[model samples]
Target chain A: MDEEWIKTTDKKIINLIRLTRKNTLDYINKDINVSTKTTRKDLVTNVDKSNEQFLVNNIREIDPKSKILGEEGFGDNVNSMSGHVWIIDPIDGTMNFVKEKNHFAIMLALYIDGKGILGYILDVMQNKLYHGIFGKVYENDKEIFSPKNISLNNGLMGMSAPLLINDYDNMQSIAHKSSGVRIYGSAGIQFISVIKGELIGYISHLKPWDIAAGKVMCDSLGITVTTIDGNALDMVSSETVLIATKIAHKEILDLVK
Target chain B: MDEEWIKTTDKKIINLIRLTRKNTLDYINKDINVSTKTTRKDLVTNVDKSNEQFLVNNIREIDPKSKILGEEGFGDNVNSMSGHVWIIDPIDGTMNFVKEKNHFAIMLALYIDGKGILGYILDVMQNKLYHGIFGKVYENDKEIFSPKNISLNNGLMGMSAPLLINDYDNMQSIAHKSSGVRIYGSAGIQFISVIKGELIGYISHLKPWDIAAGKVMCDSLGITVTTIDGNALDMVSSETVLIATKIAHKEILDLVK
Candidate 1:
């Protein structure tokens, strides 16, 4: 696709995603009853299902041919990403949303033929969006330069629950080498750290929706996002994703391997 | 001490701590020249040292006989809690403060003859304060009941860098049994989680100032604050401190031992 066409489509999608996110935040913020959908562990609070359904319905209307993969099970069982694919995490940090009532985000990513085209990470409380299209990344429309490459020994890192304990793929070694480790229980916030260069990397075992948008945003900023073993991630599958600066990436990969 | 006397002293000390914290925050927020005081591994930013001095000066003016032990070496080299000993962590999460400008806290605890008389943990950005005197806990002047006693299997746990990596005293086994583990790099914030019932407990290798205030606050709320081996803590020494609810305390001790 041409640059101009990409820009136009990107602008439209960015505005749409922002609107959808704001609506979702507003809906949840309003007084409402909450209930468990399937099991106590699996919650489907009014906001969760509503947000996913809203995104799916709007995406279907806007691009009838695209396949949607959504966390709330509102979309199809997308087995392949052969054509246009839109991955949505309506509420990426449900526990944080339900408990802390904050630190959650709405993540959306668009991919065409396995290449990330656009990404959006909406930080609800701060009302700042870390977004990107093609080669450019932005924080509320202001262009942000990629942070200087920092090594594990000099910067903090973010690791998820299971990874921090099990030493899954030698994560224990990586955690020890980094200056510190932070776990905020939100993929969107973790991605924001990578973009802000506050953290050297974030490693988590995540679903497609949890990382799709973040992957696109990181890729645009010259950051590396890959599997724990330094392999390209299959966007449609759950994997141990490591998003980091170039130097941190090398150190983590070495330590983990 | 009588209950009424404890309550009154708690209120007075809490107010004083809040005022001192606000003054320190304002001073640091202003642009000032800073130089490294120690190895890059152990930074003593201008704000850290100056904040301690500010607290020391104010404490001496208010209570000339009180002994203050502060993080930045501006206060007395406290070896005993013989009188009205005040333990202060001018900036609990200095790295976070210097880097992200958030997540750090000013912690103060007043012990009268080796007994905790008052404690304050201030969340600067949110402007919320968790404080306690005797057996009553308060969040910003409102009474706060002890959070539901959650078990290790049902709640999150917090671990510091060394504990999480080296599995100090078999922390790995205890962490594996919990729902998840979170590391936020701030002693005050981690203590806030326990007091708020967000985490089952937090374990960290810390100094007297780093944990003195948290120890008092947690103990007042009926939470266990002790060394990992279930020994009483020496207020003047650095050790692996474990703060948790009753059930989590029992479970973690069993697992780690």
Candidate 2:
């Protein structure tokens, strides 16, 4: 892929995703009826489905041959990551958006021939975006240098709810060694923390869209992004994902596995 | 004790505490000298010790004969609440202040003749203070009504790190029943959430200063503040404290105990 073309498309997609987030926020904040998608486990408000549809429509217009893997079923059911692929999570932290009205984000990533080309994470409340073009990562407009590589004991770590409780692969022991564990219920926020070096690492069982953008951003920053067992991440599948600095990643894998 | 007198002293104490928080934020944000007070577990940076000393001096100047219970040991060792007593946590979330440079708070509570007269929790980052005077509760300058009674299954809950892992008295079961759990490593932020009706409740093994202001604010809002076993809180002792609305409180206590 041409680097200049990737940069241009990345900027366009980033703006589109930001617009989608703004629309989603406005829609949810408006007086709209809310219905449960499933008892309590899943929720499909109008904003969520509508935002996904909006992203799909824009991406289809821009890249007619690309495949989209979205949280909502509006996008095609992608089983492989060949050619150009766009992975999106319209409203990443749905629970926080619905309940607390804060701490949610918009995530989008582009992959060409199974290689991550662009990544973007928009933190809605903070109004900041962590984005990467090709191999260069930026927070908002300025380039963000890689954070200091601190061990788990010296930094905070973000853990998902399920991993914390069930000790998913001995996460409890790993959490004990860290300064502390913070669970924000949003993969995007967790990923941002990992990139900012505020958190040594973030671990969770995530879908493709949840980890797609994060994986590219973390990898570009010289941080390690992989499964809990130190296996390479399969971009097309849902699996346990870990994003961390090199030292923290090794420490966590050793402690957990 | 006259109610009018209690009200006057409460307002004065809240003002003093707010000023102390401003001083702490100033000191922490800039370069400051620090020394280890005791073991690494118990830290006494210049900001921590100086903030407490400032609070104690102000309390002495305002109420010469009042008893004071403070975290930094600058005040007299208060054994009983015979007269006016002020419980102060100069820097409530020290680890967060030292590590993250945010998410910490200053907590202050006034008890007149063993009764809570005033409570204040300053969320430094958001710049909002959850305060209580007599029967009214305010977040910053605006009065906030108590949140609707929400069940454990419908709301989020906050818990301390240790309790979550050790399953201290079966807290895991209680957490499992709630919609989700959040651990922010700051008693002040956790308490603010409870006051704002964000979290159904917050649980932790807390010192008197850690729980004092939050307890008074929750009490004023018709929320229940007690030990995990449903015992009234002892203002001078550290215990497993649980603060929640009526229904969520009962449900969690039932599951935990």
Candidate of highest TM-score = 2
- After TM-score superposition, what is the CA distance of residue B243 in candidate 2 from its true location, in Å? 0.9
Give the per-residue lDDT of model 2 (tens digit) for A121-237. Answer: 999878889998767889898998887888888778888877888888898888888878888888998898788767778899998989999888888898899888899977888
The whole-model C-alpha lDDT of candidate 2 against the native structure comes to: 0.83
| Per-residue lDDT of candidate 2, residues B1-257 (tens digit) | 67787667767876776777678778866885654455433445778788889888988988798899999888889888778888888887777777667788888888877888788888776677888887889987799888768999888888987799888878888888887888888899999888887788889999999998988888878899998899997689989998898999998878875
Restricted to chain B, the TM-score per model reads: 0.91, 0.93
Model 1 lDDT per residue over B1-99, tens place: 567866665666667767766776776667744455554545567777777787788778766788999988888988899988988887788777665
Clashes of 1: 0
Which consecutive 10 residues in model 1 chain A have the weakest lDDT in total? A35-44
User: After TM-score superposition, what is the CA distance of residue A7 in candidate 2 from its true location, in Å?
Assistant: 4.0
The estimated TM-scores of all candidates read 0.85, 0.92
TM-score of chain A for the candidates in order shown: 0.92, 0.95
